[model samples]
Target: MTTRPPGAAAPATAPPTSGQTPEQAALRPGLKNRHLSMIAIGGVIGAGLFVGSASGIAAAGPGILLSYALVGALVVFVMRMLGEMAAANPSSGSFSAYADRALGRWAGFSIGWLYWFFWVVVLAVEATAGAKILEGWIPAVPQWGWALIVMLVLTITNLASVGSFGEFEFWFAGIKVVAITGFIVLGGLAIFGVLPGSDHAATGFDNLTSHGGFLPNGPGAILTGILLVVFSFMGSEIVTLAAGESPNARQAVAKATRSVIWRVGVFYVGSILVVVSLLPWNDPSIAKKGSYVAALDSIGIPHAGQIMNFIVLTAVLSCLNSGLYTASRMAFSLGQRGDAPRSLVRTNSRGVPQPAILASVAFGFIAVGFNYLWPDTVFQFLLNSSGAVALFVWLVICFSQLRMRGIILRENPEKLVVRMWLFPYLTWATIGMISFVLLYMLTDDSKGGGRVQVLLSVLVAALVVAISLVRERIRRNATQDALASR
Candidate 1:
């Protein structure tokens, strides 16, 4: 563990490069404080919150608030643990790097690749989603053409420099934040019978009970709703990864960790509260128009669908942009640690990992091709195969933090800027909750294909772990042979 004196002045632009490997030193700290701030704020608001929450609302009724809260709490804990490690030692690899030192080489190798796989797959998903919206707006261009354009534009944004990625994300996330905040405010007004020209019949807290009543589908649906909504929280950890490129990495990480609770509460749970309050959970429009759009349309907002389409498009682009940046950085980190090809560590004069960026996007473009070529079979398999990765990632973070806490405390107590509350007990509880979620996923075949997703994800994770073990053994044998020669 590397430790700076308690009161030493922190670097203004990048993490200390002292004793850094060539690959680690190559990354530039071009992300400003404002960029990191918005990334942290925007990281909590994924497109899933806007487009995917309707089914959850339907499944749990108004009690879906509880589902979001439960998952939000889970994310809070995981980020806390991750923040502790990241604050102590900022790394582009983030949790994967912590896993390497705390668990073993295999732990880091498996999870890093798994996380990289998750994001590149996300690139295809977001690109296709954006393409659908673009095709709707401009009928002349084909969906595939829109996808190609979106990918190329963002790829260029990332390739230009890390600062450009941050600037793009800052505005993309800013638009989403403003849009959702506006929805919540307008919806809240209509619910209170204060908004003029509002004639929607279903409004107020009574909607929670007037219909089938909260939790009308029964208490089990809350768990079912968890399956629907958990993945929406996937990008919340992107801030920790982005922190590595910030000058004030440790302080930025600590602040982001502290703010996650409210961010999740206000953006996710708060927005859904307005949605359910503005209309009954079971309203036909809720399912047809989506939660946000339905709430806006209920209040007599014009062109609700198109308004949401624009917001969703912005979110998809933000996600695609962050997805490419994240996947490439993780690959660059993997290369630094010898878990990937040495070529991945190669950077251009601007300190951009061109090879890593190209490698990630190459896979993304291929995934987009699969989506078009085999929408039903191959693409569906790809989606399900990566579905449970978020849970897998949080689970690994819980385990890694359990070991990393002790390691940090022993090696350098001063570096513990962000501490996980209640130590081992809360960590253990988080582990239990995550494990239960995974186990529960195996039993349900709800809207998200929980059972199939979990089973396929497990199969894919096992394959990666197997590869990691084989690589470790081969490397171990090589080291032993060198010792014998010596």
Candidate 2:
């Protein structure tokens, strides 16, 4: 029923490099389509897939496969909607900007700050995770020391140039893609008794049914499994943000968006299928040894644990790399929009948002120190506090797309290069699904501390919303006062 107001201009189709106005061209076009493509392929494949799937398997048994499929479908739907908006209005702020245009300044300000909080928290969490791997490999440095080193390294990479961040992520994500693809190929061969000299004749589709049927923990566990794996899909939207820096942002976003659903669906569901297929869901080895390593060890892969550890290390670094980049770009966007300090909008000679990068990393370092000193008190609260923010971000995207679609249809239908399937119907379905997930989180208190996490996230979100409203009022008052004086 709603429509774009009269005189509202249709979204422009400016190539990032050839766009008019010196202000628009200030952001360098360092990222190529290949970088965007790789980033998309690799973004969904996180360290959590390798390390965290064990908990989901333990929770849901072989039925965990269904959980992954369900979550993958949800992500595909959400991304389709997000791509439709991002492809039309590419910006460093991404969904935040969309929320601003579609909803209001309040929605955009609250979601932007909350999203930035999520990634900054992620920076600390991932830094600690990478530190553990390094400390395990070479005990020369202590855990805290390793954490500091990893944070510093990635911070430098981001500050050096956006191109540096792109290059680093390209290789990091490449290893993950190759590793997962190899696992799927080799594991499938082993299941079919085609792998040479393999003891995998026992490994087949039977593993899925042999232990307590397909639903070992019953159908309810699938919901629990969803909570476990859903967070792993958080980084999938990084490609949309990276698209803003590309020479051809609209095409880049469209290409990345179109390819992401199939790639992520296959990579996540395919690899998980291989894992549960190779070993029984209740295999003792899976818990004692991590999921991927146990699956590799099942077929007698040499140094499986070491190889998996290296791969996980790469994933952690990739996440940290992209986390810093995403957080800073978001800060830069917020600064430009007046939600954050104006200094954050200033770029170095290389067109790098240095202040934004430093500010984001500074918070990350403080979090690292909290982990070292007061982990149980402060860091634990911080962890649980931001836990459900990914769901919140997804919810905002769903609503933003709903309003954005109406605007695009009325203003310029041609800008909708990537369309959400089924329009408003599926869009509403996705929104309902996300709301169900959040409510599910509130009631579920299995193992991952779901109830406490959701409660804390709610409190944090409320605080941010309040701050945004208060800031808006203050600005409104100031504007009125200025007009009265004039």
Candidate 3:
């Protein structure tokens, strides 16, 4: 840590709303605690966890659970830092605003834009996923039609009001929560051989070690599993970002971060455990079908796969909605801070950022056209470019909190409601650990052109730096010209 001057002004550390103007502050107290709580719950349980755990298990066997645990721990650490920052200065901009204040204009510019990129990419990906599931259910409709319907419907809901979006998400998240709870309940019963038709004798804890032993490929596989499954937790932190728009943003951040572990850890580990236990790693259906629905179907539930596809569809839509909202909000914030074009600062009567909405829609349309054309090239290009941003965002959160913490401790320690454990130590460790993870990913086989993606993301970050520098110079020249005229 760098030393600070004895009398310099430290950044204030009160909760996030401390920085928002009155107008922005009045947007909406519309999202209730229930909505936020469920958002936190549902955010952790994305389509990836339900359908993608098979890939992790295949890569690492039963040791995949350890992979999730490592990532979960890292997320918990990162969220704690984010909570500390959000508690002090919750705003619609969330970490972007924090980055601007604590780091500098360029850090905020780069990280904020990178995050917007991530969400936009996510918006298209979720829309596509939702479309595929809907097309399966209604073959008469083309997949692109399903994507359009999904986007426009959610777009209208979001445009209506914050309350409308929150309410829509509330029910969608409710369905997911109930379904996952039911899954755990049913899987538990089957595990103990209590279910009505639980015929699999290998459902007990013995399965953990029986199949070529627990670490089938050795302890190294657990690390490999982490490489595969860490991305599944990507959407979870979006809750804190979204919560900045809620009433009592600081409290929401604290509460959401406090409970993140249980949501990410239990759901991930619990679900994956039940999965490998229910069926052997080498089972064809695990690869042929998927891990989530297949696990339910194995327990004699009729149409479990279809039911799960529907649930996964809901998950995808929820993500698309949130993705659109997040990207737009970031763009709106950037415009407000002079990092983007001024037009995005406009808001409709409903306080919706209409320009931001249109921008998001424009990107979605591009994704739509790409999907219609050569999806493989476009999707791969988008995925690879945005692949490294999550780490970048996490790194920003860590640095922001590191600087924000001291100012907070000195100025108003009482307001530090949701503090990171071990503070400076854990904060530094998280930064280092994440650095190592990035390095590890560079060498992973599954990365498959990850290097190019990482390289391009770095270039994007550099571009932001260049723009910020140019903007600052222009602003200074204008100021000098005005002074000379006077």
Candidate 4:
């Protein structure tokens, strides 16, 4: 069951099969190796890493480094499982397709729609954040106007051609990779007092331990930091999804999964180590300015705040670009699986799923409007409702892979190009860890939004499950009626 590479001439609608439909043939394989490589490299570094880390440091002190390491390891394990299944069978559906085969229609439909909801919400969040920055810089266009403008531009790019989206993401992600890598190099040199003209205030490992010790707030704070920083890692799985559109999807997914370990280690843990070592965790500058900017200032970089603002803006745009692409693909897959409107599976002359793209962006724009109309009440509910969805998606991937691996071995052993480490054991461990995180979210309300997010996400998941079951029942009843009539 090899997937037909995109850009190849799609055959006229084939006779629909019982298990799968015929509409999975139109997406173009316009994503190049460079686009995928940069997306993998830059996906882990998000706007959260730039602007959100200050709070994490304040919570866990220098020990926040350990929180990153813990979460980074969890992501690595999850991606390894996802890569194994993806290498065996790549689809625009990605994990949703696997869940359908391994679990059932309800599992696939529920998870697919949930994942789509997660990204659409992200589209609103990132757009609003980016708009504020653009408005601040230009001051001519208002924030709402900027949000509309940004969404419109990216939507056009996505509808134009898959390659255009790939090219835009290539440069957007490339800027982020360069910024973070430059920060790591410059910050590391400054920590050792080797960078010329660097600020001499508080350099070396002493900064890590000198300020009330490494676990300044206490060992318990690491869990708090974990909750704070884990959401930043949400987009790391985009590489596997993007790989489905590559020419050699199996090889691409395999390569990306293998490389993720070192990338996360270097870009995340290494960068944080430099930040903590270069300046004390309790530094007033870290709280006032972002951690990354404070690190830059410590190294005598002028206009550190303005420089970081540019990088953060780049990150927000990159996220919006990827989020739209992801949501549209999910919608297309769901339609092909008969869980969504069939129209969503239709593609344009350029092999782009124009209907799906528009549908996903329409919801995103609506969310942005709601954000403007009711910033504190209605919009905040929307934000919290989708907050814990990333964890839910990861948990499904873990379960899907577990079932998929056994079926692969029994049915098609040769297709196993990538395999999860420690097979069933680590697979089960990953599931347990994810469940623990969700349960922890339920018990902990101190984050101001944690409990509400978990409860609302559960409520959303339950609603999706109920809808899928009801739809299945209705279809089954209709089929039986036709048979009896015949």
- Pick the lDDT winner: 1
lDDT of each: 0.90, 0.88, 0.79, 0.87
- The stretch of ten residues in a row with the least summed lDDT in candidate 4 is 14-23
Task: Give a tens-digit lDDT track for model 3, residues 70-93.
Answer: 888899898888888777666667
**How well does candidate 4 score on lDDT at residue 34?**
87
Number of the candidate with higher TM-score, 1 or 3 = 1
Q: What is the C-alpha lDDT profile of model 1 across 1-486, one tens digit per residue?
A: 223467776544334653222224568878899999999999889999999999999889999999999999999999999999988888889989889888899999999999999999899999999999999999899999999999999999999999999999999999999998988888888888888788866456998888888889999999999988999999988988888777788889999999999999999999999998888888999999898888888889999999999999999999999999999999998998899998998878787889999999999999999999998899888899999999999999999999998998997799899999999999999999999999999898754488999999999999999999999999999999999999
Q: Give the local distance difference test score of model 4.
A: 0.87
Candidate 3 stretches with Cα past 4 Å from truth are 1-23, 445-449
Write candidate 2's Cα lDDT for 61-129 as tens digits: 989988998899899988999999988777888899889889999999899999999999999899999
Candidate 4 local lDDT, 1-486, one digit each (tens): 123465665467542222122334467677888888888888877888888889999999999999999889999999999889888777788888888888889999999999999999889999999999999899999999999999999999999998898899999989988888899988877877788887555467998899899999999899888888999998888887777667767777888899989988998899899989988899899999889988888789999888988999999999999999999999999988899999998988887999999999999999998899998888888888898989988999999988999998997699898899998899899888888878877767754467889998899899999999999999999999999999
Residue 289 of model 4, lDDT score: 86
Clashing pairs in 4: none
